[model samples]
Target chain A: MSSRRDILDLLGENARYTTEDLAHMTDFTESEVEEVVAELEDAGVITGYQAVINWDALETDAERVRATVELNVALDRETNYGDIADRIAKFPEVTSLRLVSGDYDFDLTVEGDSMREVSHFISDKVAPIPEITQTVTHYIMESYKEQGTEFDDHDDDDRLSVSP
Target chain B: MTLEPADRVDAVPPSGIRRFFELAEEMDDIISLGVGEPDFSAPWAAREAAITSLERGQTSYTANKGKRELRTRISRFEDAARDLRYDPDEEILVTAGASEGLDLAFRALLNSGDKLAVAQPCYVSYVPGATFAGVDVVDVPTRAEDEFKLTREVLEASGAAEADALVYCYPNNPTGATMTGDELREVAAFCREHDLVVFSDEIYADLTYEHEHISIATLPGMRERTVVFNGFSKAFAMTGFRLGYAMGPEEAITAMNRVHQYTMLSAPTTAQHAAIEALDNCQADVREMTAQYDRRRNYVLSRFEDMGLSCFPASGAFYAFPECPWDDADEFAEAFLQEQKVAVVPGSAFGAGGDGHLRISYATGLDELKTAMNRLESFIS
Candidate 1:
């Protein structure tokens, strides 16, 4: 079976379970969950761990703003993708990081309380590195759907299953 | 054809402007106001400058941002008109036109699925441009009572109050509405507060009837948030010349410059030289054109009123947007052409709120306009 079926079988049974719960439910140990998670991460199948928060219950005064940050970087031989990824991945507030096609090198999803906090994080923290050259940031005013977690289940075998 | 997996074609749509042009071409001798290109030619002096550059044999590609001379001229032009100061070397960039500048701005700034806010009944370019950049466009529809001016209330109501960027156009196309200096300052303040990057298209800055064009970038704390798009097309009558520029934070310009270099290399060599002359020697030409347009604007409005159609006096730009006497603007526009041989674009061609109106370009000769009005009167009656 494909790794997707294995992962789907896991999530399909219980989606809200913790990593430990998932290990227990699957009759595997917690160390096995860690191993599978690592394997999935390496295979580019399981992309992220999201904190699904109820905004109304979490913080009444919170004003969450989504901003798109375009970073212009100048990396040295020593400062490769791994180093740069490691540097940016440290910020818990950065929800997503993508290597895009075109003028900008990286596009970042930054969350903050206000515009000032967002700008400060980008200008002061993200842009000050020697490997970093420049940055252009834009705050999201509204979201039709804020990057929904919909796993596209494409069954390659199902198409061929009908074919001879 | 289906068997060849390698022969699959990209399913992209044609450019809005090109599609409009193609539609306009179908009708013979159609006096089209559909395409938003200036009817005037480049000034003699501006044309002379391009000739001079050709004589100097500058055919090779220029710096990605632009030639220092052209950027310097643009800097002076913005400073004189809107009191916004930009560093020619660091902040200003030349592109094929305002269209290309917009394209670069979005590609450099937007990621996939990023939402950008736009005012409705705007230039048709914004929607398609945002679509091409893999971003969603959230339109903030301006009311007729607001004179289609982009206001704080409009921004607030858009549900897009936090859009990644706001594309603003003033002395607007189709609707000839303009924003005052004070209004721009308020918008700038709002943008700063919301962390919205303002893509201000001030292409029609020179064509305002009663007031001066205000640059949002001039407002306090706005230099960092605003990327302005301007060109020689509308004001300097160099639409065919295809020269435009963007000015903003050095970081954005640097990113935008790379896109310009790769995609277009530079604006036409001749157009850039001509643009410099346009900045220098064409002030009188602009005044002359503005005066003629004002006369035509008033004439068209009066003619529409005389024919019992309601028309709000346009404050800027050369087009007169009059409410169609009939129910459907598209039907009226098509039938008028068939019966009276008068060509005007249905306002619906622009966007949603434009359904009941018709956009008539007064860029034609006065005699032709008079004949068109007479024909229109007879057809309607």
Candidate 2:
């Protein structure tokens, strides 16, 4: 019961943590941990678990190019930005989409193998949407950091093996 | 000419922990639960602040007392955290580290032949620090039965009631013992009756798990007589920065600064800038790091319980002192390292009341801790 949050926080940080590990880390027995996790998964609170990968460190052939597309859409009593947002969101390249307030109406991330591929997806798929008024795309060049993890920080435990 | 150590060498022995370090160096695949420091790096913003300071050519020595902004920030932080206020201008003297602050306290507060009663099974440096200051020390061993807390009864038994001053830390190192409010008041009353000036080293203040940290300096009449030592080393994961400070009566701080001026000149300029950022914006970072330590603490304790090994309910610090289930802790630690490849500190290194126990620091990664626990279980069984 107390471990529901502890499980969520632990699993959120590292998906590799197992039930036995979570049981030890939290105030739950192994069976109790399994029960709580199952309830969370059943309720869709435990949506999915995936690794936070440093994609840029991989082989160039496996590299991905991503961009944030600021989407301006025309809306009337008949059609809204949500309608067009749903249409653009169907493409697998559209990884994250949010209808935010401010300079942009619908901001989204589109990923592809190369900048040209991202540009092509925008022109072919995103531009075909009738209600979207304008699409501005900025290709991400390199990521120095992501999800609070540094891509280039090589911090070793250089401290003494034992200290007072 | 033969290079000889200073005259004080005969009085102070090399660190007891140093002997165990040699065997560990030659071992392969050792998972150390032995390190006494936090595993996390200093918060990134604080690191960036230092870089920005360096880039702006803020490289000169700071004021002997320290950067006023950092002191003011420290004053506000203490006021908010513990409701204890000090005049930042006269009461605070920044030093190179909490280690330096302790050394400064010994020099500024006491004279030769003055008595300093130290709570034992303590940090390795405290006794030696007092000895180097030329103060005769009386070791008051707080017991495992008392959760290693410094009770008035313990003081009465040790003849520390006659000492001029008492030196201790809550969320104590090695034992992880802390005094509750009522418990602290009892000790505070003792200090008052005994006419003992207090040097409360609260370096691990921000790391306690069971309750919000309570400082003995907060007790009535204690503000004027107590010197509170703290820093960013453990809490902010900023050990390498070597920035800490002492807050106390203006006279004591001024005297400490008198010595600090000639010896240290000032703490590193960029590190002071980094400390300002830490105090100004890193409260959440400290809480986050402490939460992580709490989780590790729970996990390690649970593992110890499963193995039927008894550990005092350590509510503070990143360590848990589990009584050795085997014959001798020093032998157990060496054998555990040799057989299981897991490194832990023999409690005897910390002084009296530490023998027959092992200090397991849970500041390592959780996965690594799990592996170490598994190895430890197998080796013991």
Candidate 3:
């Protein structure tokens, strides 16, 4: 009946569960699991299967720094916040962008290889855009949590392997 | 110059599950499905309440029959969940887990030479507990056909009529079987006919999936003779708290409380505080955990079926009792552990009619359960 909901719930917990595993776990057969997944995709409910990684744990030289920029802009008679938001959202460095209320017109999160690169992006690229009255950028120092996951903490299932 | 233990203690054999638990400890990277408790941790609200109580120096022992506040809450909780009522002060006696409650029930209701009929394949503690309570045990085998439920036919065939009391567990451990309301009515009539005092263990009452648990004690003419034992361990993920309560007639509860006061005194005050919070605010958590177990239960059942092993349709608790492909469950379980690094309890450990099967628990994460099932399928192949 609610096979779609069952599959979605299992995948939502761990997106890496394969179709074969889903079949064994669910009442749906292997082919049925695939069909359900395809149906969900077609309906645009499932956009992608993502791996949530802790970027700070990597030991690469190109360490990324993230910043949240609040953009306060003026809307002209012809140009509105939607047009300006679209222009800023197209930047490769922009990871998240939203039209926010209160003092800021658009709130955005940007990631770059270094602080200098991110600062240069806001100064050169963002400031040049017309209708941009003010900008405030705050670089994240440390992440305690993100995306419903606690940072720097690895989950260990401490239950004994077997009991009776 | 030699010391000898009590004869009765020496007479009873040690548990069969202990051997597997020890062997599993020595092995490396063994994925186990033998767990008898929930994998989830205790609710945060309960833990927070316990901490607050402890910080306030609430370290003294509670009343011999447990705290009045907790008992009132338990009484109300039972009334709401099962429509069963207890007079909080005289009809409810909280103990240290259902284990102690079983022991107290045996001593309270049965004499030293009296017989205690127990349903098999039952929990590991019942037989030994009966022995420790100085009562004779009669085993009544409940088959998969009966949904592991005790019935008139099985009871009559077992010589339980001669026994003074009976111990029954629903949403049974190892089997994960439950009794429907109609089925329970039939058993109640049987008990009434034989004048049997029943020790109803409903520890997994809140863990039942897809159906509301109907206590046998709720049926007419059954409450006076039944002592329903339930606890915080299974449903609330509070196994370590070691708190349980027995609800029954005033006479039996007073008798149980007398023994409890002289021997164990009372359940821990900290655990009682946690339990109070758990009963008050953790309904949603209990429902969520039950729903999670239900999904994993279906997944494990399908895996066993695909492997050509027939499993009882377990609609309650978190276990799947499936027939072992091989005749000897012990040999099959050992080889499964050795070859695939996966551990499952041999069904024979649970007693009569439990042979030629395996008890697989589904109270685990979906990822780990998937891995264990994959390993099991490969081993069987």
Candidate 4:
């Protein structure tokens, strides 16, 4: 049976426990935690790990701005696009990246203090990529909810309509 | 009886909120702001009405339209509270909740491939509901500068005015924004011109602190084009009870009733009895609760503002939409939990206009609200 510890890490907070800490939390042996982690990694589920930094740590002065860059790419250029995304994803400003359907191919979430910060990243970093053809940026004007894998309650029937 | 996959199949996904809540339950010291349910209990009179009905052997199924007393009470409540008049026998049909009324409206009025002009920063259910009814939804984003309230200008700008329908929800859930009389008048006029059916959700009507809630059905000629949806959930603090009703023109009501009769048959008889009392006797209770929500709403708005998070003052309902410190609102909300131990929903759950904002629900106790505020400050600062 799959460990309950592994389920919690996937569905809830991924950072809630270290391998050893999860072993303790779930009252399992350390080997059990290690085994679960290994299985998850082999399955390509536990892809990567990083620290979640506090927003206050990033800014010295001025307000914060967020923008979503919608990219359109063809299927034929998948390998080249992956290489481009890998390089762009290395930027300190980029937070999340997802391949989406509809009008855009890849949705890149970026944050900075001003529109210039976002524009500079797009022009300096993203636009230089070879496989990218079109891009549309949506500056987030307001938010109602945003919890990465935490509080999102998306139903399968979620509909998307373009804003003209 | 043998059933085909199409006949027996279910389409809507199971609610993720409840599943997440169950997961969070295993973690100790987790304070949840996940539920959209009210924290308050149903009033004693409403409870007593249910008990009385059981004692009087009123457990049998009611008429498909609902109990006559409940229907009459619903009509009076609409006329007295929202200035909308309807014939109890022809124009009012009790539903399981506003959810059911919303579903009935979509199922009855919408043809396949019809486009519904939906305001963004709307309740999560509206999109899914439209989809299940086989209609396409076109989102019209209500601006942050305008407090996320829907206006005729926003609707007109969508260029889908010629579409089949409009799904309206004010005293709205996620944003807590509402439409005023002037706005409703313009919407009514526009709908009349386009012959669009308006599904107006007034579930939070009595909870509005800024202005008296107005019904689009009350507008001249709007009764024919508007389906007014309301329930006991918000106003009477009866979310678990699940009693709601819809009012509209006789023809529309009849069509919706046909769907309701087959799908639901009738709402809970005990709930219907209790709902009648809620309509008749719970006005004062609603006022007191609304005042409490107003206090919490004001408190949360000020808290967010002081923390340098840009927030819009919520005009109705019990939520505060505060800007998060990250570009991805989801990342911000999750980081907040890791740092502050406070849980707030990421704005992206409501659709496009919600990025960079998080919704904080102030539906718990004053002390819990204060603790959440302090945790939020500690995290943000």
Q: Best TM-score goes to which candidate?
A: 2
Tens-place lDDT per residue, model 3, B247-350, is: 99999999998899999898999999999999999989998888788878878888787777788788888988988888899999988888888889998899
Which digits, one per residue and each the tens of the lDDT, describe model 2 over residues B67-109? 9999999999999998779988999999999889889989888
Sorted by DockQ (best first), the order is 2, 3, 4, 1
Model 2 TM-score on chain A: 0.90
Model 3 ranges off by over 4 Å: A1-3, A69-88, A98-107, A122-136, A152-161
Candidate ordering by lDDT (highest first): 2, 3, 4, 1
Candidate 1 per-residue lDDT over residues B1-381, each given as its tens digit: 465423112323443335334444565665555446555676879989888989999777887787889999889878888898999999999989898999999998888688899887778778877877888888787766777778888889886676889996888877888888887877777788888889999888889877888888887888898899999988888877888999999999999888888888888888888988889889999987876676567667767766887777687887777788899887887788766666677776666567788778777655567678878888888
Q: What is the C-alpha RMSD of each candidate to the true structure, in Å?
A: 29.7, 2.1, 2.7, 26.7
The model with the greatest DockQ is 2
Error of 3 at B278 (Å): 2.2
* Position A50, candidate 3: lDDT: 80
Per-prediction DockQ, in order?
0.00, 0.75, 0.51, 0.01
Instruction: TM-score each candidate.
Output: 0.66, 0.95, 0.91, 0.67
Worst 10 residues of 4 chain A by lDDT: A155-164
Task: List runs of model 1 lying over 4 Å from the truth.
Answer: A1-164, B1-24
